[model samples]
Target: MGRLLLVVRLARRDLRRRKAEALLLLLAILAATTTLTLGLVVRAAASDPYGTTRAVTHGPDVVAVADEPGDPIARAAGVVAASGPFPVAPAKLAAAGRESDVQVVGRDPAPTAVDQPAVTRGSWVRDGGVVVEAAFAADFGLHVGDPVTVGGRSLRVVGLAVSAAMAPYPGSSCWVKAGCASGVAPGTVLPPGLLRTPGLIWLTRADTVELAADPVYLIDLKLADPSAATAFATVHNGTAATPKPGRVAQGRPSLFLQPWPEIQADATRLARDSQILLLIGAWLLALLAVAGLSVLVGGRMADQTRRVGLLKAVGGTPGLVAAVLLAEYLVVAVVAAAAGLVIGSLTAPLLVDDTAGLIGAAHPAMTWATIGLVLAVALVVAVVATLVPALRAARVSTVRSLADAPRPPRRVGWLIAASARLPVPLLLALRLAGRRPRRVVLATASIAVTVSGIYVLLILNRFLNGNGPYDAAQVRVLRHVLLVWTVILLALAAVNAIVITWATVLDNRHSAALARALGATPGDVTTALTAAQVLPALAGAVLGIPVGFVLFAALMVITDGDGDRVPQPPPGQLAAVVLAVVVAVAGLTAVPARLARTTLP
Candidate 1:
C-alpha cells in the first residue's frame, strides 16, 4: 500500500509539471462529452416519450386520415370503436389578429372518443363552446372564461385541459409544401395550417349521422397485436380506408393507412442518424486526444527512462514499476470520465429538443441504461490510449537509460551528402530533418488524417444537397465548403511541413557545417532538405483522397423516392482532386525551402 501511494504521488507530480498536456486532454474530453450528451439525450427522447402518455393514451395501431368525409375504412372503425362518426376539416383561425391554420373537428354535442380532455370550466357543447388544446390555448392567451370566434360562429372558451391525442408525439405540426393558400377564410375556425399538411380532428357522431355524411374519410384502428402492425396494414390494404380505386380529391392523392411500427421506424431512423453524428464527433475528439497525449508521452520518455533506472537501483521489480506507471494514467482517465458524464447530462436536453422536432415526437425520459452506455464508451477510449506509454515505461533497462543523452542521435542520409553544395541554411535544414524520420512521419500522419476528414465532409455536404450538379445552389454550397476545407487543410499541412523542416535543420547544424566544408552550396542543401519533407507530404496527400471517399460513403444513408435530379460526379472533378492533392503537397514544402536558402549566410 505504501509503494502504491508513492506511485500515485509520483504520477500526480509528473502530470502537475506538464500542465500544457493536461489542458489539451481536458479540452478534448470536454468537447466530446458535450456532443455525446446532446446526441444521446435527443435520441432517447425521439424514440419514446414519457411512459405515462404511452400508457394512458393507448394510441391507435394505425391512423389513416382523409381530406374529405366518406371512406369505407373510417366508417368501419367508427362503428367498431363505438365512437361517433366525426367531421374533421382543416380551418384557418384569426383570433386577436394572430393567424395560424388549425384542424377544426366539428363535434356533435355528444362525445365518444375515450382520449378526450376532461373539461374544466365551460359546457362541453352548446353551439357556442369550443374546446381548444391546452397547449394551443396557452400559446394564444385564451382561457375557459374568454370569448372567441371561429368559422363565423361566436363561441365561449368552455374547457381547458390536456389531451393525450394532441400532445405532438409525432411532432405538433405536420409538414406543408411551399404553397397552400386556398380553402382558408379570414375568420374561419380552420384546421391549423399544420393540420392541412397531415392531421386529425373529430366532430360529434350525431353531426355525421344527421348530416348523413359518410364519415368514411379515414379512421384510427385500435388493434390487439402491436407486433402485427405490418400484417394488419397488408390485411386492410386497398379495402376501406385506402383511396377508392380511382378517387382523387382536388387533384390531390387520397389518404392511406400508416401503421404504428411504420411511424416508429421513421422516428427510430431519425434518432439513430443524429446519434451516429455524435459517434463521429466522439471519434474526432479521440484523435485530438491522441495528438495531445502523443506529445506528452513523447516529451516525457527521457524522464520515464531515468525514473526506471532509479526504481531498479532501489530493487523495484519490473511488474511493480509497470503498475506504478500505468496506474497514473488509469487515474487520469477515470477522473475525466466522471467529469464527462456530468457534463453530458447537462447538455443532452438541447439535442433531444432539436431531434424531437425532426421526428415529430416529444422529449424522452433519461434512463440508467443510456448513462451506462455513454460511460462505457468513454472508459474504453481512456484505456486504449494510455496503455502503450505505461507499458514502455515499465520495461526500460537501467544501465542504458542511465547512459542515454537527452538529445536524440544525429544521423546523415545520402540525400544530405549530395546536397552539401547547397547554401548553408539549406544544408542545415536538410540535415536536421534527415536525422528524425520517426517524428516527421508522425507529424505527417496527423496532418493527413485531419485533412482527409475535412475533405470527406465536403463531399458529403455536396451529396446531401441532392440537386443536380448543374443546380447553382447545390454547386454553390458544395464549392464553398470544399474550398474552405481544402484551404484549412493546406494551411495546417503547410505549418507541419515547415516545422518538420526547421526541426531537421536545428538537429543537423553540425552536419550542415561539415557539408559546407565539403563544398555544398546553400541552395543545393535547401532543395534536398525540402525534398525529404515533400516526399512524406506527397505520400500522405495521395492516400488521403480515397480514404476520404470511403469514410464519406460509410456515413451516408441512402433513401429512395426523393426526385432524381442530382448530377453525377464529373470525370474532370476526379482529375482535379488528384491534381489538387499533389499541388498541396508540393506547396507545403516550398515555403520552407525558400526560407532555408535565403536565410542561410
Candidate 2:
C-alpha cells in the first residue's frame, strides 16, 4: 500500500509538472476518439430515424406498385396485413394567387390504423375543409380557413397537422430532370382531389367509382414487424425475373415489395459517405497523437531516467518504479478517453439529425451503448501507448541511471559520419535527423497521417460536392476544397519537420566540425541534413494510400453497387499533390541548407 501510494504521488507530481504537454496529448487523443466514436454512433443510430417515422406515421411495411387496372401483388401481400393500391390525386393549383401543381393523397384513411401520422396542430380530416401539414402551411404562409385551389377547384384549409408520414412535404425535388417538382407547389392545398379546380381531382371511392388518375404504384402493407418487413421484401425484391410486360406493367401493381430495405439502403448509403469524413478526422488525430507523444516521450525520457535512478537509490524496486512511471500516462489516457466519449455522445446526435433531414426522415435519439463503446476504445488506446515507455523505465539499470548526464547517444556519431558522404545539404540534414530515430519516425508518421487524412477528406468533400455519377452541378461543387485545406496543413507539418531537422543539425555544431575535419564538405553536410526529412516525407506518402482507402470505405454512406472503387487519380493530380508536398518540405530546408553549405571551410 505504501509503495503504491508513493508511486501514485510521484506520477501525479510528474503529470502536474508537465501539465501543458500532458494536456496537449490528452486533447489529441480526445479529438481522434471523439470523431471515431461519433461516426460509429451515427451509423448505428441512422436506422432509428426511419423506424421512428414509420411508427409515428403508421407507414406500411411493403408498398407494391402497378399503374395498370389489374395489379396482383397488392392483393397477394394483403394476406398478412390489410393492403391496397395507392391512389394518386394530382392537380394543377392556383391558390392564394399563386399557380402550380399539387398531389392529394386519397386512401381509405381507416384500414391501416397503426402508423397514422400524428396531428400536430388541428384535428384530422373529418369533413368540409382540408387538413394541411404544418410544414406545408409554414412554407406557403397558410392558416386555417386559408383558401386554396387544386385541380381547378377551391377548398378551405380546415386544419393544420404534422406527421412523420408527411415530413417529406409534397412535391419534393427529384434527383434527375431539372425543374421536375415532386412536392406540392407552394400556396396550393388539395385534399383527395375530389373538388375539381384547374387540375385533376381524387374522389372518395363512394363519391366516384371509376378511378380518375392512373395509380403509379400500390402500397401493399404497413406492419409493425421490421423483420417480417425485411424477409417479405427480400423475397419480393429478389423475385426470379420480374413478370412479363403488360401483365402487371401498366396501372397494375408490380410484384415488388419495398419496406425497411429501401429506408435502410438510403441510410446505409449516407452512413458510408459520412464514414469517409470520420476517417479523415481519424488520420488527423493519429498524426497529432504521434507527434504530440513523440515530443512528450522524447523530451521527458532523460528526466525520467534520472528520476528512475533516484528511485532505485531510495530502495524502490523496478516494479514500483515502473508502476509510478506508467501511471501518469494511464491517467491522461483515461481522462482523454472519458472526455472523448462525452464529446462524441454530444456531437453524434447533431450528425444524425442533419442526416435524417437530408434523407427526409425523423431524427432518432442517441443510445447509451454508443457512449460505452467510445470509452472502451479510449481505454485501449491509452493502455497501448503507455505500455512500452513503462517497460523501458523498469528495465534501465540503477547504476547507469544514477550517473546519467546529458550525453549524445552512441549511434549518433556513426550515423552522422555516414550521412556526411551524401549530397551537400542532404548529408547534413540526414545526420541531424538520424540523431533521433524515434523523433524522425514520429515526424514521418505525422506527414503520412496528414497526407492520409487530406486525401480522405478530399475524397469525401468531392463526394459531397457530387463528384460521382450522381453529381448535381447546381447544388454541389467538389472543386478540391478539402484537398486545398489538407495541403495547407501538410505544408505546416512539412515546414515544421524540416525546421526541426535543421535545428537538430545545428545543435550538433561540434559534431559537424569534427566531420568537417574528417573531410566533409559544407555542401555535402547540408545535403545530408536535408535528406533526413525528405526521406520521411517520401515514406509518409507511400504509406498513406492504404490509410486513405480505409477512411474512404468507412465513411461512405451511399455508393454504387459496383463496390468500393476509388476513382483513379488522374496522373496530373497525383503528381501535383506529390510535387506540392515535396516543395513544402524542401522549401523549409533550402535556406538552412544554404547557410550550412556556405559555412567557412
Candidate 3:
C-alpha cells in the first residue's frame, strides 16, 4: 500500500506539472470513446422511440386486413383485444396544388382500445375534416385548418398525428387490396400499378364511403401474449396465396396479418444505418487517437530523460519508475473513458433521425458492456503508445539519461548518395525521416486513415445529396448521422497533423541546430520539416483510396440487395481529396516548423 501510494503521488504531480499536455492526451482518447459510445447507445435506444408511440397510442400487436368489411379474423385465438373493421380506400389526395396517393382510413371521435393515434396538433376525427399523419403533414407542409381534397372532395386538415400501426410515411407499406409499389419500400413486391409510396390520412366513415363506392377493411388486434404475435399472424394467414384484385375467397378469405415486432423493425432501420456510420467513425477516431498518443509520448520521453536519471540515481528500481510512467497515462485514460461515456449518452437523442415520426426522446441506459468496451479502448491506446517508451526510459543508463543525449543517427551510404543530388531541404527531409522510421510509419498511417475517411465521406455525401430510393425523412436521418461522422473525423485528423508535426520538430531539434550551424538557413530547416510530413501524407493518401473503396463496397452489399445499382463516385473527386489532404498536411506543419526553425534550433 505504501509503494502504491508513492507511485500515485508521482503520477499525480507529473500531471499537475504539465496540465496542458495532460488535457491534450485526454482530448485524444475522449474523441474516440465518445463516438463509440454514441454508436452503441443509439443502437440500444432506437426501439424505445417506437415504444413511445406504441404506449401512448395503445398500439396493436397484429394488424389484419381483408377485402370485405365484415369482421373476419377478430375472433382468432390469442386476441385479448381488438379495434376496427375500419373503412379504408386508396384515393388521390390534393393539397397545396400537389397530389399524392393516400390510404385514407375512417375513425370515430371515441378512442379505441388498440391503435388509437395520439394527436400531436389540433383535434381528432370530426365530420368533413381529415387528420393527416404527422410525418406526411410535415412532408407536405400541411398545417391544421389547411385545405386538402380526398378523391376530388375538399376537407379541412383537422390534426397531425402518429400511430404504432405502421411505419412513418414512406416506410408505411400498403394495406389496400389493389397493392402498391415504391422504390423506397424494400422487400415489398406486388402485382404492380397500385400506388407509389403513398402517405396516410384519417377521415370519418361517411367521408371514406363517399370516396369509394366499395372499400376494403382493416382490423387492429391486441394479443394476450404480444411476443407470440408473429406465430398468431402466421397461423391466421394460412396457405392461401394473395387474392387478385376483385377476387373473392374460396373458403376463408386471405387475411394478411402484420405483427408489431415487424413494424418496430421497419421503424428502427434508421438506427442501423446511423449505427454503421458512427461505428465506422469511432474506428477512424481510434486510429487517430493512437497516432496522437505516439506523438505526445515521444516528445515527453525526450523531455523526461533527466528525470529518469535522477530517479535511478536515488535508488529507484526500474520497475518502480516504469510503473510511475505508465500510471500517468492510465489515470488519464480512465477519466477520458468516463467523460466520453457521459457526453455520448447526453448527445444521443439529438442524433436520432426523424424525431417528429416518433413521440418521445430516446435516452438509452449505459450498459456494463458498453462501459467495459470504451474503457478497454482508451487503456489499449495509452498502453500501445507508452509501454515501450516507458520500459526503455527505465532501462537507460544513469549517465546517458542525465546528459540528455540524442540517439546517434544511422549512416546509410545509399541514402547519403541519393540525397546528395536533391535540394538542401529535400535532402534534410529524407535523412530526418530515415532517422525516425517508426514516427514516419505512424504519420503515414494517420494520414491514410484521414484520407480514407474523406474518400468514404465523398461517396456517402454524394449518395445522400442525390436523394435516391430512401424517403426524404429517412434520407434526412441518414444525413444527420453522416454529418456527425464527418465533423468528428475532420476534427481529429487536424489535431493529429498538428501533433505529428510538433513531435517531429522536437525529436529532430539537435540535428536541425547542427544543420543551421553548417550554413543552412532557417527557411531550409522549416521547408525540410514540412516536406518530411508531406511525403508520408502523399503515400498514405494513395494507399487510402483502395482501402476506402473496399470499405464502401462492403457497405453497398450490406445496405442494398442489388449493389450494382448504387452509383460510384467519380475518379476525379477521389484525386481531388488526396490533393487536398497533402496540401492540408503541409499547411498544418507550417506553424510548428517555423517555431522550431526560428527559436528551438
Candidate 4:
C-alpha cells in the first residue's frame, strides 16, 4: 500500500512537472480512443431513431407486394395481424418546385393495426390530399398544404409521417408491379423489378384509383415473433433481400416481400458506411498513436535516466521505480479515455443523416462494452508504449544511469568510407537512419498511412466522377465521411512526423554537436535530419500505393463485391502524392531539426 502511494505520488509529481509531455501523451491516446468510440457507437446511435420510429408507428415485420389485391400473400406460420393489400402506384411527383419518382400508396382515412405510419406533422391521408413520407418531404422541403402534382394530376400535401415498412427516400422498398429504376440503387443493378429512387406518399383510396399509372397491391404482415421476419421473407420469396447481380426473372413471378430488418439495413446504410470509414480511420490513428508514443517514450526515457538513477540512489526498488514510470502514462491514458468516451458519445448523433426519415437520435447510452473497449485501448497503448522503456530504465545500473552518457556509436569501416565520399548532410542522414532504424520505420509507417489515404481518395474521387454505383445522396454521405477521416488522419500523421523527428533530433544531438565541431555547418545538420525523415517518407509513399489498393479493394468487395467500375488513380497523380508526402515530412521535421542544431553536446 505504501509503495503504491509512493509510486502514484512520484508519477503525479512527474506529470505535474512536465505539463506539455502529459498533454502530448493525452492527445495521442485521445485521438485513437475518441475515433474508436465514434466508430463503435455511431452505428447504434444511427439505429436509435429507427427503433423509435418503429415503436411509435407500430412497424410491420414483413411487407409483401402482389399483382392482385386483397391479401394474395400465402398463409404462413407465426402470423398475428396484417395491414395493407392496399393499391400502389409508381408515379412521378412534381412538388415544391421539385420532381422525383414516388410510390403512392392507397390507405384508409383511419390508421391500421399494423405498419401504422405516425404522422409527424399535420393530418393523415384525406381525399384530394397526400401525406408524404417524412424523409421524402424533408428531401424536397415539402410542407403540409404544399401543392403537389402526382402523375400529372394535382393534389395537396396534407401530412408528413414516418414508417418502418420501408427505408427512407431513394432506397425505398415500396415497389410497383413493373418495378422501378433510379440513377443508382444499392450498387448492383437488377432492373425491371428493382425499386428505384421512390418516395413514399399516402393518398385516399379514391384519389389513388383515379391515378393514370398502372397500379399494384401491397400487404404488410405482422409476425407473432418479430425475430422470425427474415425466415418469413425468405420463405415468401425463396431468396434473401439482395438477389444475385445480373439475375433475370424468367417468367411472371410470385409476390415480392421485404422484411423490416432488410428495410432497416437500407435506412441505416449511410451510417453503416460512415461507421466503417471511422473504424478504419480509428485504426490508422491507433498506429500513429503507437508510433508517436514510442518515440516520446524513448525521448522521455533518455531525459529521465538521471532521475531513475537518483531514485535508485535513494534506495527505491526497481519494481517501485518501474511502477512509478508506467503509472504516469497510464494516468493520462485513463483520463484521456474518459474524455474520449464522453466526447464520442456526444458527437455520434451529430453524424446521423439530416433527412427526417427517422426521429433524431438522442444522446447514446454509454454501454459497458464500449467503455471497456475504449479503456482497454487506452491502457494497451500506454502499456505497449512504455513497458519496455520503463523496464530498461529500472534495470539500468545506478552508476551507468547516473553518468547519463550518450549511446556509443558503432564503428563500421566500409560504410564510413562510402559515406565519407558523399556530401556531409547526406552522409549524416544515412548514418542517422542506420543508428536508429526504428525511428525511420515509425516515420515510414506514419507517412504510409497518410499516403495510402490519399491514394484511396483519388480512386474514390474517380469513382464518384465516373459511372459509380452510388446515388447523389449516398455520394454526399461518403464525401462527408471521407472529409472527416481525411482531416483526422492528416492531423495524426502530422503529429507522428513531428514526434519522430523531434525524438531523432534529441537522440542525435551529441553526434550532431561533434559533427559541427569537426567541420559540418548547422545547416548541414538540419538538412541531414530533414533528409532522414524525407527518405523514409518517400519509401512509405511508394509502399502506400499497393497498400491503398488492397484496402480500397477490400472496401469495394464489402460495398459492391462485383463492381467493375472501380478506377485506378493515374500514375502522374500518384507521383504527385508521393512528392507531396516527402515535402510534407520535410516541412514537419524542419523546426525540430533546427532545434537539434541549437542543442549543445
In terms of lDDT, the best-performing candidate is 3
Per-residue CA lDDT of candidate 2, range 1-601, in tens?
Answer: 5877887889889989988667766765676676766666656655666555566666666655445436655445434554445454444545678764444545454545533445555555543355564544554566777777655556667666543332233212111111122212233444442221111222333322222334343454655465676677667556422221111111212444556455444434344445444545554764556564644554565557788999889898888887887788778777876786676656655554332122244333355675566666665555555566667777788988887754474467677678657665566566566667776777677767776676665554543443332213211222332332354455446544654554445455566777788887776666666676677777777677667666556544333222233353455765566666666766776677667654433
lDDT of 3: 0.83
lDDT of each: 0.51, 0.54, 0.83, 0.81
Q: Report the lDDT tens digits of candidate 3 across residue range 1-601.
A: 5779989999999999999889989998998889999999996688888998999999999988877767658887788889988988889989888888899898888999999999999999999899999988887788999998889898999999999998776567567766665453333444453765678999998888888876778899998999998888878876323222112222234477888887887677678778888889998888888887887887897789999999889888899889989999999999999999999999887777645667987877799999999999999989998998899889998999889888788777788899998999999999988888888898899888878888788777776664544567778778887778778778878887888888888888889999989989999999999999999989999989988888888776665534454566788888888899999999998889888965563
Candidate 1, superposed: residue stretches over 4 Å from native: 1-3, 47-58, 64-216, 223-257, 264-272, 354-368, 406-445, 452-546, 558-601
Query: lDDT at 128 for candidate 3?
Result: 88
Using all chains and alpha carbons, the TM-scores for the candidates as numbered come to 0.61, 0.69, 0.89, 0.91
Lowest summed lDDT over 10 consecutive residues: which window, candidate 3?
A: 240-249
- Clashes by residue pair, model 4: none
On residues 322-433, what C-alpha lDDT tens digit does candidate 4 reach at each position? 9989999999999999999998898887776655777666456789999999999999999998998899899999998899988786656676778888999999998988
Predictions ranked by TM-score, top down? 4, 3, 2, 1
Maximum-TM-score candidate: 4
Candidate 1 versus the native: TM-score? Answer: 0.61
lDDT of 1 by residue, 398-486 (tens): 78666654455666668667767975655554555556666666555755565566655555455555332112322343344244334
For model 2, the stretches where C-alpha displacement exceeds 4 angstroms are 44-51, 66-83, 88-216, 236-253, 264-272, 353-368, 406-418, 421-425, 467-531, 542-569, 582-601
